[model samples]
Target: MYKYDNFDQTIVNERVEQFRGQTQRFLSGELSEEEYRPLRLMNGLYIQRHAPMLRVAIPYGLLSSKQMRMLAQIAREYDKNYAHFSTRQNLQYNWPDLERVPDILADLASVEMHAVQTSGNCIRNTTSDQFAGIAPDEIEDPRPYCEIIRQWSTFHPEFSYLPRKFKIAVSGATHDRAAVRVHDIGLYLVKNGQGETGFEVIVGGGLGRTPYIGPTIRSFLEKKDLLSYLEAILRVYNRYGRRDNIYKARIKILVNELGKEEFTKQVEEEWQHIKNSVLILDQKEIDRVKAYFTEPDYDQNAGDDTGFESALNENSAFTSWASRNLADHKVAGYKAVVVSLKAPGIAPGDATDAQMDFIADIADEYSHGEIVVTHDQNLVLPHVKQADLFTLWNKLSEQGLATPNIGLLTDMICCPGLDFCSLANAGSIPIAKQINEKFDDLDYLHDIGDIKIKMSGCMNACGHHHVGHIGILGVNKKGEEYYQLTLGGSAENDAALGDRLGPAFAKAEVANVIESLIQVYINNRDEDERFLDTYRRIGMEPFKEKVYENN
Candidate 1:
């Protein structure tokens, strides 16, 4: 976790003062609701269906136990007793008072967190694998770079107002848990053929009315030129990205209109003008940023714990949860634990105040007082000792945070649909619940392994449905809720957009349609093949044929 320097602290403090003034003006009627709306949105305050929603950024998904406790306190004192964690690795308070939002921002600044860039058409939160530092296959920790980008993009004068929102994701691991391919800009930290570390840059990727798989704009960019390269990409996008139509403003639409070659050429030409300048990497600045993320003092020989294996064999629930929720840690005898937010009937990503407190306590006790928010709407304790696995599981289960379904059908990624979002035409949380109930069986869900099921209320694709192994997009047709399905999509290393599975299904029929598609995959898959692999191998024809034929 990056500690705030004087400059960082000053900016946050100043922004709070700025927003406080904005709040005053809005409340005093200097700005109309229409006028105040965009200004407030830029500050991460949304006037939701019922009340104002305040989104607080958890940069690169990192949170200290102290910070987590502060969030818990905020939820308890200010708004509802719960907060919804978003796919962008942020937290949203769904019922904050409009007048008190400035105070909230002030409080967040105390803990080095704020709401800026969580909303509006600016560079949004940069995301990465929750297990970045501890992931076994990581090339390097991505957080330092993520933090650098976070600092650079925060209120960058030229990019604060873009044609549409911009999102960026980075991945240090071979596995793309960050969903990099579907973001506006995806940076894969890589080692080139010459053994120099750099980024494999992909551009023009997003999901909305139009879904696009980002094209590789740069095969490799030296690590030193990161900021300059990113500036080049954004410069090109801001200059040429469509603004005439709201429906087609995303970089994805621009990329589609101009093919990848032209897009790449434009970015390259832009980079040529900016590269090797003062904006290029400064070793001193890189060190200053990277210093905050130096590895914690971890025990060297924390070898395999036989006690954990014994516990696994004895408790079936614990074993199941461990299997799905635990990830391989780079350090021997340590594990990365996923605290699933999609437990049974609870709204996906809604963590009550008590749960946050519980997580804070657990991180303090089990991990090194650190926690991470995953883009999958889950929380991660990246360095839990293997010896303490059973204890942590029991504690989490007691707190309703231990759901043994990760990457399974029940672990759904959903947006705040019609229930809270003014933009949503249909409810996504209920749809997730409906599907969750339909596939509640632990064994069954585990058998239909590693499926990323995402849902969005509308085509804005906040839930990232376009990249789900089984994507569900909500639509309203003649006042009835309907869902369009897409299959074969993926967010991993070989990211690809899902093909449409066919016609939309009525809300009631969604579960059945999904089950039928899963059954088709089961029938066609080879030994131990995941849903995505099977979908890619056989294509959409088999699943599409089965799903629509029965209808």
Candidate 2:
């Protein structure tokens, strides 16, 4: 984790006080609502359907145990008993008092966390793979570059207010766990034939009312030119991106209208002027950022723990959880344990204050006091010793954090729909619960295997519904809530938007619809085929026929 220096601390502390004044003025009626709107948004405060929502940034999804404890404290003292973790790997406080937002910001600054850029039509949080440094398939750690972007973008006057919100994602692994293809700017860290490292840049990828898988603009870009190249892209978007309609304001729309070739040409032209400027990162600076993410100390004799093997043999429950929740680590005798937030009956991506505290303790005890939040709404203890697996599993199980449903049907990504978001067409949490109840059997879910169910309450696509294996979008038709389904979408290496399954179904029909689709996959799948594989092999006709047969 990157520790804040005096400059970082000073900036955050100053911003807290500045926002404190702005909030006070708004409350005192000295600043009109129009005047306070941008100010509050800049500080990551939103007036939601019920109460004010505060989104706190967890940069590139990294969190120290101390920061986690602070988040738990904020949840306990300020909001309700729980907070919601968003798809961007940020945390949202749904019930924070408007007057106390400054206090919350101040508290967050103390822990080197704040809510800046979590919302608004500015550059939002830069995200990366949850398994960044620890993944076995990674070419390099992407966090240093993510941190570089964060430093470059925060309060950059040129990009302070773009035509629309901007998102950038980087992936260092062979697997695209960061969903880079669906971001405004996606960077895949790669090595060329000569073995020199650089980025494969993709632009125009986004999901909303209109969805697109970003096209690669630069096949290879030197590592030193990263920031300069990003600035060029932003400059192009800021100058030409549509400002007349909010719906057409994202950079994706600009790229679509101008064509990928023209967009790339413009960016390249702009980059020629600045590529060798001060924006180019030097080796010293790169090494400094990389130093913050160095690997933790490991025991030399850590392999082949007999106790862990015995526990796996003795306990079927632990075995199942391990199969689903544990990921392979690059270091031998270590594993990345995913702490699932989508346990039965819990709202997806939400954690109670107690659960947060318990997780912080677990991180300290098992993962070297570090926690990583995944964009799929799960937490990762990225450096857990294999020897301590059984005991860690038991602790997580006791706290309701060990669901063993990672990447399963029930471990869905969902947004705060009508329950919290005013823009929502329907309630997503209830639908999630309905799905959970319908698919309560672990054996049945395991059989279905590795299906992603992402639901959004509206077309804003905050839940990333467009990229799920089974994407569910809530729609309002003639004042009645209905759910639409899409199949075969994936957010991994083969990134693609899902195909719609004909017509929308009533809200009550969603769970049954999902069940029918799953049954179709079960009936049609070949040996060892996943839901996505089966869907792609047989196409949508079979699943659509099954889902709409009784309608």
Q: Write the per-residue lDDT of candidate 2 for residues 1-551, one digit (tens) a residue.
A: 79889988998899898899888888999999999988788778899999999999999999999999999999999999899988999999999999889999999999999998888878989999999999999999999999989989888899988998999999999999999999999999999989999999999999999999999999899989999999999999999999999999999999999999999999999999999899988989899989998989986667866787889999999999999999999988999999999998999999999999999999999999999999999999999999999999999999999998999999999999999998999889999999999999998888888899999999999998999999999999999999999998988889999999989989888999899898888888898799999989999888877877777
Put down candidate 1 lDDT per residue, 1-551, tens digits, no spaces. 79987999999999999999988998999988888877898888988899999999999999999999999999998988999999999999999999898988888999988999898999998998898888889998899899989999999999988999999999998888898888899999999999878899998887888887788888898878999999998998899999999999999888878899998888889989999787798878788888888777777766657889999899888888988999999888899999999998998999999999999999999899999999889999988889999999989989988989987888999999999999997889989888988998889998988888999999888898988899999999999989999987887777777888888999999998989989998999898999999988888888888888865
TM-score of each: 0.97, 0.99
Clashing pairs in 1: none
What value does the lDDT take at residue 213 in candidate 2? Answer: 96
Report the alpha-carbon TM-score of model 2 versus the true structure: 0.99
Q: What is the C-alpha lDDT of each candidate?
A: 0.90, 0.93
Quality of model 1 by C-alpha lDDT: 0.90
Candidate of highest TM-score: 2
User: In model 2, where do residues sit more than 4 Å from their true spots?
Assistant: none
Indicate the residue-level lDDT of 372 in model 1.
96
Q: Given candidate 1, what's the lDDT at residue 18?
A: 90
